[model samples]
Target: MPARVFVALMVTDSGALTAAELAQTLRVSPAAVSGAVRYLTRLHLVIREREPGSRRDIFRVRDEAWQDALANRDALLAQYSGSFAEGVSVVGRETPAGRRLTEAMEFFEFLRKELDGLMDRWRAHRDAPRPDGPPA
Candidate 1:
């Protein structure tokens, strides 16, 4: 999969790779690589860049890929919670189905709030000095 290829590149010393290079490394077709890159690009997990003095389009994972991915879930959470709330209203608050929807909506709302706090804590931790030593 393209995600696996991206992870491979991340673990390797070479942090970026051309489509052909990625296909070769992953034993997949160039078209597969392209599709993967396109998906990742849309999700803001990967970026496309030109190799200086070359025409090759290199694909590399963004530095904040994880953070961006996690943050993007807020929109999905909000949509799910909204839909659940609507379901509860349609089913009537006293019904079992309505209670289930209410529980789900509450859970999602809690997660949405916690996600914001978690991201903030992560940023602080990321910026904090390392007592052990510099990062590898």
Candidate 2:
């Protein structure tokens, strides 16, 4: 359902949809759409906002949604790395559990470090001049 909502929003010209509209488009109940939107919102794949001067909420998928989601993951990676580091410290690095935790910590730390460069490269590719015109 989240996938459906995401695709629906992506293909939508307005890049935004109300819960009732999503339900109608997807042929699902309002409750289903609500659940899906909640999940997507938590994942940073979609944003929810109240319809101005109305009670209905609108969900929008911005041009930078994907980029923002990926960038937000850097903080999660750091958090996981810190957690594993703390676990290792508590268990003693020489213990089997500590060794596992240390490995996990290193992996997350590596990803956090690499994500910066990866995002930069992505921006460069995204911002590179188009064939028909110059860079935006």
Candidate 3:
């Protein structure tokens, strides 16, 4: 349901919707929309805000939602790397299981570092001058 709502917001011409609007557009009940929005907001996928000059809340797909989501995983990657490294020590480095854990830890650490480089490359690509010139 959250994925549905995210996609709906992405494809909307207005780029924002009220819960009632989402409910109507997706043919779902208000309760379902409520639950989906709650989950999405926690993940920073959709931002909740008030309509101009009104008290009603509006939901919109965040401009950097994908980049933000990917970037947010750094801590999680570090957590996994730490946990796996601990497991290697617990099992003794000479054992097969310890070797496996070491490999896994290294993989996650590599991902954490590569993710930083990947984001940098993405920023460079995004900011690079266009050969055809700026949009009209």
Candidate 4:
């Protein structure tokens, strides 16, 4: 499936769509939709849920899913930063490699901080209600 089609399905307000529906909307084959759904599921970006009283599965984005993805990213950055910081220590700060390692670690650290902040904001916005809606 194309990225745009995948995105369209995921971003829908209903939170779920069938492969057939997605294929129709995207003007693509069911095989393409299936492929995209499989890929998205592998990435943990989309979930498949069986509908009640039916075998047909719907693809949906989980609530707090983006927050979880952000957390995973933060974990990766933190791990990389820790390892690179240690490398910087071993290389000696006065050397070019050491300086480069330090810079890389610093960048990852900063990115981790940014991801943390972004996750917080995402949660806040997600939990907040629209002006016309009830309390979140």
User: Which candidate's TM-score is highest?
Assistant: 3
Model 4 lDDT tens row, 48-128 = 999889999988876666667668787789899999989988989879999999999999999988887887787788779
lDDT of each: 0.88, 0.92, 0.92, 0.81
| Cα lDDT tens digits for candidate 2, 1-136 | 8999999999999999999999999999999999998998898889998999999889988568888899999888989999999999899999999999999999999998899999999999889999989876
Model 3: pairs clashing at backbone N, Cα or C within 3 Å: none
- For all candidates, what are the clash counts? 0, 0, 0, 0
Stretches of candidate 4 above 4 Å error?
Answer: 10-13, 86-90, 121-136
State the lDDT of candidate 3 residue by residue for 14-81, as single tens digits: 88999999999999999999999999988888999999999999999998888888998998999999
The numbered model that scores best in lDDT is 3
On the 0 to 100 scale, the lDDT of residue 89 in model 3 is: 85
Residue pairs clashing, model 2:
none
Find the 10 residues in a row with the least total lDDT in model 3.
127-136
TM-score, per-candidate, Cα-based = 0.90, 0.88, 0.91, 0.71
Model 4 TM-score, 2 decimals: 0.71
